[model samples]
Target: MRIYPIETGNFKLDGGAMFGVVPKVIWQRTNPADVNNLIDIAARCLLLEDGNRLILIDSGLGNKQSDKFFGYYYRWGDHTLDGSLAKLGFHRDDITDVFMTHLHFDHCGGSIQWNKDRTGYEPAFKNAAFWTNENHWQWATHPNAREKASFLKENLLPMQESGQLRFIQRGDTSFLEKSELGFDILFVDGHSEKQMIPHIRYKGKTLVFMADLIPTVGHIPLPYVMGYDTRPLLTLAEKELFLNTAVQNEFYLLFEHDAHNELCTLQHTAKGVRLKNTHNFDEIFS
Candidate 1:
């Protein structure tokens, strides 16, 4: 199976929100903030060419949102989801499955688009089956007050309305050994309800799509939880277990929100699990 990194776009977010209670004096060492106190973020998605099934994980924020709405995020960069796909000699119509880690605007917003005449919304990947766990589907559709802003209806309903929405039947456990997409999934709840972290076995290595569980190398320290997480305490425990397991298993973590670092591996450190090495996708895969 061949896998490709699809860079959707780049944007800046408040460093304080990204690092939660972690002091700026500390997080700044790893993720330095700009003069505006915002740090760079990338919507890096993953594409897998496994046989005939061209699967994409985490579509980045699409361009359908109004300028006013996008101004809040302070977008930057020339990369785009469409351009990235074209670079790989593929297109949105070529995607057979779209595996969403969660329904946050920045993560799944690219799944829908404004139809002709802008009268209504439609599935961005018309031929692709939008995949998400049933539990998360419900949670996202009926979002709570704290998360309501992140779960936009324009980013969701269209998938279901297009009758292309599919759910991975999960057992009563935090980890699913195999999903319908032929990859393992680690369910995390601290960030959001039932956030699915994909563990793809490829090229004799396990490349894990870190998603919101461990967004960046800066977030590896466990206590550096994002303020956006609903259950910070649960996040601490989940991160501890996942980080330890990642080090023991020697998994390669692919970051979705980290603008600079592409991938990293962890090791048991004096201060618990810490980054062992950083690698460019082609550098290690080559």
Candidate 2:
């Protein structure tokens, strides 16, 4: 099995919102903010190749949003999902499965695109079966006001219309049962209802896709939750529980929003817990 890091794009977000109640003095060091107090973040996605299946995890924010809408985030980056796929000798059509961690625009927007002539939306990966949990789907479709903006309809309706949308049943980890690169799906609702993070066991090491649950290494501290989360207190509990398990199992965390750091290991520290070490993806895998 082979794994590839697919960088879709980069965008800036309010650093304070990203770090929640964490003081600027603390988070600014790891993720320094711009003069506008925004930080650049990567919409990093993962591609897994196992035998005949080429699966993609989370599509980045697509380029379909209006300029006015995108201007807020200040999207910047030469790397695009299409370009990255082409670099790997693959294309959208090559993807057999698209495992979305959640339906947030930054994470799932690239899953659909404007069709030719710009009449309506269409599946970005027409050949792939879009995977998301049934509960998460309902929650996103009928989103609460807090998360409504992040769950755009243009990015989601296309999949259901394409007839490629499939909801994984709760506790069903057999999504990749036939593949050598099978993953253990870990669901947590603190960030959003039933968000699935894939834990892949490869080469005697476990690599976990740290979605919004742990957006960056700086979020290792228990209380450093994101302001965007619907339930901040629930996030604290979920993060603490997950971090404990991650440290105990020595799992490698793959960050989705961290622009500089791709992966890191956690260890117990006098101040609760902190990053034990940090490394690039290729460096560790190589």
Candidate 3:
């Protein structure tokens, strides 16, 4: 199996929102903000190439939104989903599965795109099955007031319309359930309902995809939960448990939003579990 880092694009978000109640004085040290108090965010997706299946985890924000709609996020950089795929000598049609961690726009927007005629939406990955659990599919489709803005219909409805959407059944257990993708899934509700974090066993190491849960290295601390999380208190407990397991198992965390850091290892510190070392995908795998 081969794993490739697909950088879709970069955008800026309010640092305060990204780091919740964590004081700017603390988070700013790691993810420094610009004059407008916006920090860099990456829509970094992962491509898993196994025998006959080419699975993509998270599609990133596609370029279908209107300028006014995108103005809010302040997107930057020239990286694009198609361009990134081409770099790897692949294309959208090559993807056999799109494993979405959650249905947030930044994560799944690329799942749908405007058709050639500009009449309606279509599945961006024409040949792939879009993956999201039953719980999250309902949560995103019938979104609550707080998360409604993040779960854009344009990014979702088309997949169902195209008849390519598939739901993963969440086991009765709380976390770490076996998935058809040849990895175990760790479900955490604090960020979004049933956000599936894939625990991939690759090359003798377990690599956990850190979706919105622990988005960046700045979010390693237990208290650094995102303000966007529905239940912050629950996040604290979940992070503690996950971090402990990650440390014990020596898992490599793959960050989705972290612009600078791609993968990191955790070490038990006096304060708490902290980043031990950081490396790019090639550096670690090669």
Candidate 2 lDDT over residue span 1-286, tens digit each? 8998899999999999999999999999888999999998999999999989999999999889999999999988698999999998998999999999999999999999999999999998888999999999999999999999999999888899899999999888689887776589988998999999999988888999998999998889999999999889999998898888999999999999998899999999888778999999998875
Candidate 3 per-residue lDDT over residues 142-252, each given as its tens digit: 999999999998888889988999888876342223433348888999999999998888888888999999999989988999999999998999999999999999999
Encode model 1's per-residue lDDT on 1-286: one tens digit a residue. 6889999999999999999999999999999999999999999999988767888999999999999999999999999999999998998999998999999999999999999999999999988999999999899999999999999998999998899998887753322224333478888999999999988777778899999998888999979999999999999999999998998889999999999999999999788999999999998775
TM-scores for all candidates: the values are 0.96, 0.98, 0.96
Error of 1 at 15 (Å): 0.4
State in Å the error of residue 232, model 3.
0.8
What CA RMSD would you report for each candidate? 2.4, 0.9, 2.5
lDDT of each: 0.91, 0.92, 0.91
Please give the ranking of all candidate structures by lDDT, highest first, separated by commas: 2, 1, 3
Clashes of 3: 0
- Residue 166 of candidate 2: its Cα lDDT? 98
lDDT of 3 at 239: 97
